[model samples]
Each structure stands twice: as C-alpha cells, then as structure tokens.
Target: MTLPRIAIDAMGGDEGVRTIVAGVALARRRHEGLRFILFGDEAQIQDALGHHPNLSRAAEIVHTDRVVAATDKPSQAIRQSRGSSMGLAIQAVKNGDAMAAVSAGNTGALMAMAKLALRTLPGIDRPALAAFLPTLGDNDVVMLDLGANTECDARNLVQFAIMGAAYARVVLDLETPRVRLLNIGTEELKGTDEIRDAAAFLRTASGLPLRFDGFIEGDRIGSGDADVIVSEGFAGNIALKTAEGTARFVTDVLRRAFTSSLRSKAGFLLSKPALHLLKVHLDPNNHNGAVFLGLNGMVVKSHGGADEKGIANAVHVAARLVEADLAARIAGDMARVGPILSEEMIAK
Candidate 1:
C-alpha cells in the first residue's frame, strides 16, 4: 500500500507549533505508512519537534516565512499571505506534492485559501464544509455547508445533497445513505422559495443513486432520521453550534446533579462509565474537523482552539479520506447525477 502524504499547517491554532508537532507525532505512531510535510517556519517546527525523537525521522518540514493571523479576513489572507504556512500547505496539495491538507486556522481563511488553490470540482458551484455529528442511533449523521458559503440557491442545495450523499457513502460506508434537506418543517411548502424549488428539483431528479428522504426538521437532527443532512452554510453553522451548546449545557447539569450531595457523589462513581461514554459522544474535540467537500483535493479544517489530540484526529480523518479516494468518488457520483441546471452556470 502506498503511503499518503499529508501537508499540515504547523503555524495554525492557539497552541501554535507545539500542539501541531505533538499531533503529527501521535498520528505518525498510529499510522505507520503516513508521511507528513509540515508547513511553517523551520526554526519553530524544529524547536517543537526536538522533544519528540520519533517525529524527527517520521516527518519533513517545508519552511514558510509568513503566517496568517486568526483575525485576518479570508480574502485578504489569501491575497496577502500567499507565502503563509496555511496557503503554502494548500498549494502543496494542489501541486500533487501532498494528497491532503489539514489546517487549524481561521475557518474563512482556510476555505478561501483552498478555493483559490485547489478550486472546486468541474460541476460544483461552490465547495462546502461537511461535518460529522453523532446521532442518537447506531450510525453517525453528516451535516454540510458549515459556514462555507453564507448564501445558496436552489441548485446549490441540490448539489450539496448529491455531494453529501456521495461523501456519506464513501466515508461512512453506507450503501444507500438517506439524504434530507434541512428545514424548519417537513412540509414541502415550508421554508424559503429557494428551498421549495430545490425540493421539487430533488423529487424529479434522476440517477442520484442514494435515497432522498425529503425535508428534515431541525429538531430531528439528533433523532437520526437521515444519514446525511443538507443546508446552506449559515443555517448549518447555527445548527452545529446550537448542538454543541446543548451538549455542554447537559454535561454541566449532570455534573451539578452528581456533586450536590454525598449520596449523589457515590451514585456518580457508579455511573462514571456511562457519563464518560456520553461525554465522548457529545464532545466537540472528538469531532473537531470538517472536510471541504466538492474540492478537487481533500482539505480538512480543524478547530482554531484544537489541542494535540484534536489535531491528530483531524489528520486521521484526512488520511482516511485520501485512502478512501473520497474526492474521486464524489466526482463520479456528480457525473452520474448529470446536470440538473445548466452545466455552464454551475461551472462558473
């Protein structure tokens, strides 16, 4: 088996070079064939990796003098920080020097950099971010457009559904993943005019192999009614944050209840395993990264505050995506779906 070469932005995130270097070392241990190209100032990366003997021989560093600040605007960063670590890392993937790129920088900056470098697929209008959510059911659910493009048209939603379905099939190993358009209500007449029109397009569309389950209510996201959920970036981002907040609130409440009294503390000891399981299921760190779908190459966006373990998981996700040939599978699925709207329109 050929080893997957991953380009990582070592200057990204709050923890800076230290956590990024630690994450790379961790991932390298778990995945023997994984080769990494760390993009950042050579001195900083060397300083961080000096403590880890294993990483010295396992990874290579690609030096970049510039760095994109978290506060920098996406467009501005892409333009001004052309030589930044994040930008150069993405460029490596675009130039075929690396199979995938992982970054823990500003979400907008990462998205803009990737768009400018890798570009979207042949028929994709705009690429979107796809994040995994743990459902109440046995299988995990995929939610998309996680603040990639704030606005989307009916055709864009349809494209998201198709791309999302293909992603679930390849990544989640679902044969006939059920896809649903995220909406306030399940009724066809509900939501904006664009959504109604998009729903109609999906209904009459042909050759999209997966099961289209129509509109899904926001409340049913954790209910596991569908394997894949599609929505515009603005709405998807709100939904993802809301779920995270709810999970945190629930955990806090449980913690308070478990420590209120001596008896409660004793009971909590007995329930520690169950609580650990719940925390694992709801923790954002466990699902810290989102994939930039519809791009020609695999790009993963890690949380800006990601720690060593979180960054490691993001790299793991990127490695799996490359191994699974996710981008090629998505392109094949789009080709099979054909063009619902004008080919020229989407290409533009």
Candidate 2:
C-alpha cells in the first residue's frame, strides 16, 4: 500500500515558512515513509528548504502568491482565499490529493475553508475541534468542540461524543474509552436541557463503542475523570484557555520560587531531571494539534505560534489520523446511534 502524504499550509503560521519547513524536516525524521505537499511562495519555500536537505527530497511544493492573514474573518477568508496557501492546502485534502491537511492559520478561517471545501460527514451536523489534554493518569484525556460550534443542541452534543470517543480509541489506544459530558454537576437533573438530554441519549443508546460515565464537573477534568470530555465550543474553549493559563501560571510560579534564593536554586538543580519530566508532561508543544472532526476529510489546526517541535507534533497527529482512517470510524459509530437520535427527535 502507498503511504499517505500530508499537505501543509507553509505560509499560515506566525513564524512563516522557516518554522514550518523545519517542522517538516523533524516529521520526516520521525516518520521515515512520510511525504509532504507544501503550499506557499515558491521563492520563500525554496529558501527555507535550503537548511533541510532530506525534507527537500520528500516534499513537493505548490506555490501560490497569496497568503491568508491571521486577522481575516472566516467569511472574508473563504471569499478571498481560494488561491491562498491555506485554501489550496485544504483543497488538496478535498480533492483526494492528500490524505490530510494541516495548518497553523486562523481557527475560524481554517474551519470555514475546510467546511466549505470538504463538507461534513454523513451523520455529523457540524465539525468539532478536538485535542489531547494532559491528565493525572498515564494516558492523556481527549476533549472536543474546543472552538467550533459555539452553540450546540442535544444531537450535536451526542455527535461530538461519538466523534470524540472514536478519536480517543486511536489516540489513547483504548478498547472502550470512558466518555463524559462537561457539566455543572454530576446529578441526573443538573446542567442545561441539552446536557441532560445528551446524557439521557448516551445512557439508553446501545452499539456505540464507548462507555458513557455520566456528567463530569470542570474540577475533575485534570484528574482524568473521563477519557473523553464532550462540550459545546463556547464552554469548551473557555475550559481549554483556562487550563492553558493555569498551566503557565504554575510554571511561572515554580520558576520564580526556584530562583528566589541560592538554597532554592540548589534544590532546583538537585530536582532538574524530575522537573524536566514534569515540563515535558505539561508542554503544549507535545500536544499541538487540534483536529477538526466530522469533516469528510481530515483537517488538523495547529497553533499559529507553535515552534518546530509543536508543528511536528501536529503533523504526527494528522498522519496518525490518516493511518487510522478517522472518518470511517466515525461513520461506523454514527450508524449505530441513528435510531436513538431519530427516536429522540420524534419524542420531542
């Protein structure tokens, strides 16, 4: 079988083609059979490739003069960006030229371009952004709707659950991932109607390849309360951002405390290896890809400011999803829950 190639938007990130090309080199080293289709300015890409001899052979560049701006709104981006690097990269996935597409551009813009070009899956109403979150357990937790679909209905929530669970199966290597809804309380009657309704649907729904472990409050997210936590984009984005901020805050505090005195500095040197491990476990660069799930083709959104390691991690994620055939898994899961969704709609 032929190995899948990943299409990259080389002009999409904060640092431009330099960082992206370096990441391409890193990904090439990690995955020997990987190939890349990069979209950006031919001159700039050529210049950037000079430093990475191996990547130049594995990558094929498609040049476009225009680049999507980070400040561009989703509507404006879609309207004006057909020939832009980001749009062309996503179109590659839509056209079957690439197995998956990766970009570090504007979140709304990438989602818009992907949806406009590739559309949603059979039973999925909308695509949700999903990412891995470091947890107290050995395996990382998967969370969804990080910044897509600010408002979602019960059906959307259920669909997110299905997609998140399928994602967890591949990313976390689980036989049956424990799925949970992010809610105010764990009580049966707590949370909004949609939350309650989604919970009820999962409880009675059969044939899906996940274990619905009821509602989980925000406090338990870092503790690995569930393998997959599903939420609407509004709340999910807030949770994601808050957790990021708290992680930074703790790191900053630790840095300051360890440097405040000579004794503390000596202690820090003594614990350098353990602290390095802690940093690796908490680093966002190690988990830099946010997948736009429910699309017909795979679309991964990398952090705009991500460095080479982060971008390489994002590429790894896209490659893994392609290998796992995420869309097929979603379809299989969706088919099982069809009757439950229809019955609930009829009851409503």
Candidate 3:
C-alpha cells in the first residue's frame, strides 16, 4: 500500500508540539499507511516524541528556526517569515514531499502562504475554506468561504457554489449534490442585490453539474435543507461561529440541569452514555478543521485552540480527503466549468 505523506505544522496551535505529535501518532495508529513529515524546531519535536517509542520510528521531522505567530498579519508573516515552520510545511507540499499540509496556525497567514507557494488552479480566482456541518438529517452539508475572503462579489459566490458542489461530490461521495446560497431568508428578494444577481447566474450556468437548490437561510442550516451551502466569507464565518456557540451553550445548560439534584444526578447517570455519544457527535473538535478548496494541493486548517484529539481528527480529515483524490476531482470539475471570464473581463 502506498502511504500518504501529510506535512503537519508541529509548532502550531495552543498545545504546540505536544498536540501535533500526539495527533500524528494517533493518525498513524488509525491508518496503516499514513505517514507524516512533522515541520518545526527539530529539538522540540524530537523531545516530544522521545517518550513515545511507537511513534519515534514512524515519523520524520524537518527543522525550522522560526515560527509564525497567530497575531502576525497574513501578508507580512508570509513575507517576513520565509523560513518559518508554516511556510516550510506549505513548501513541502509544493515540492511534492507530502500529499497534504495541516496547520493550526493563523488562517490568513496559511492562506497567503499556500496561495503564494502552491497557487490556485487555472480558473480559480481565490481559494475558499470548505467545512462540513453535521445536520440533523442523514446527509451532511458543506459550507464555503468560511472567513477566507471577507467580501465576495456575485461571481465569487457563484464560483464558491461550483467549488462546494464539486467538493460534496468528490469528498462526500454525493452524486449531484444539492447546492444552495446562504441568505437572510428563503424569499427571492430576501438578500442583497448581489445575492439576487448570483442566483440568476447560477440558474443559467450550464457547465456545473450540480443540483442548484436556490437560497437557504441561516436558520435552516441544521435543518438539512440542502447538501451544500454557499456564502461569502463574512456571513459564513458568522454562521459557523453562531452554530458552535449555540452548541456549547446547550451542552452547558444540559450539564447544569442534570446536576441540580440527587434525582437529577441519578437520571444523568442513566443518560450519561447517550449524552456522551451526543457530545462526541456534536463537538466542534470532532469537526474542527476546514479545507482550503480550489488550491492546487490539499490544505487543512485546524482550530488554533485544538487539543490532541482535535488535531488528530483534523489529520484524519486531511488523510481522508487525500485518499478520496479531492484536489484532482476539483481540477476536473473546474475544467468542466469551461472557459471563465478572460483577463480582460476580470479586469472590467
């Protein structure tokens, strides 16, 4: 079996080297043929792996002297920190040293470095962050532009829809996945003129092989209204964070309710297993990463606060996407979209 090599930014996230090293170990144990190139300070990584005999032999490390801080501006970080761990990790993917790159560092910096190093596909203008949201129903939904591009035009939204639909088809194995634009309401005139115009474009677009499901409101996200939801980065980020906050609030309320009294505690004991299962299912950590779609290679962004388990899950997600041949599929799908606007049209 050919093992997939993933480059992990070992110096990223709050847990730093420990979380990344542990995640690599977990990924290797879970997937037989998954290999990793851990990028960071060589001494720290070696020290972290020193106690883990099982993981010491299975992974390789690339040493870097600098690290990109979460607070650094994306453009400046990429420019000034050329030899930083994050930059080096992305470079590994560009050099074909790895199949995918995973990082829990500053998202903007990662995007900038990735775009600078790997570049986008032929027809893609900007890469969007695509994430999976588990719905109440059977099928999951893919939301895009989750804070990658704060302001997007009508054409950008349409492109996001196309890229998201392609992701659903290839990564989620959904044939003819339903695509919907995230809007304020389901009514035709609910959102801005941009959304209205984008809707028109999607309706007439012939090349994208997807089931365009019109508009989907923010409230309907968890209701399973569509298989893929498209939105600008600002709105998408708000929607995602809103959902996460609500989930946390509900869990906390439930915990307090269950511990109120002896009888309640007894009831909680009986319900502990089910609650644990639910928590695992709904925990953001289990689904804490987003893939920067439309790029030449796979790049997954882990939450900066992610722990060992969360980091492991992000790696798992990246490995699964690589195994599914997501990048090639996206390239093929974009190819099928035919000739986009020429440089002149774009300049206009």
**By lDDT: ranked, best first:** 2, 1, 3
Structural RMSD, model 2: 1.3
Candidate 3 deviant stretches above 4 angstroms? 340-348
Candidate 3 local lDDT, residue 269: 94
Worst 10 residues of 1 by lDDT: 339-348
> Each prediction's TM-score against the native?
0.95, 0.97, 0.95
Model 3's alpha-carbon lDDT is 0.86
Best by lDDT: 2
Which 10-residue span in candidate 3 carries the lowest summed lDDT?
338-347
Alpha carbon lDDT of each predicted model:
0.88, 0.91, 0.86
Residue 30 in model 2: lDDT: 79
Ranking by TM-score: 2, 1, 3
Q: For residues 1-348, what per-residue lDDT tens digits would candidate 3 score against the true structure? A: 656799989998888797789877877777767778888999999998986667777688999989999899997897899888899889889999899999999999999999989999877889999999989878778999899999988878877887898888876788898999999888888898878877877776665679887999888998887889999999999999999999899999999999899999999999989999989988888887799998999999999998788888889888888888889988888787736433322443
Count of steric clashes across candidates, in order: 0, 0, 0
Q: Tens digits of per-residue lDDT for model 2 on 179-291?
A: 99999999999999999989988898777789999999998998977999999999999999898889889989999999999999999999999999988988889989999
Candidate that would win on TM-score: 2
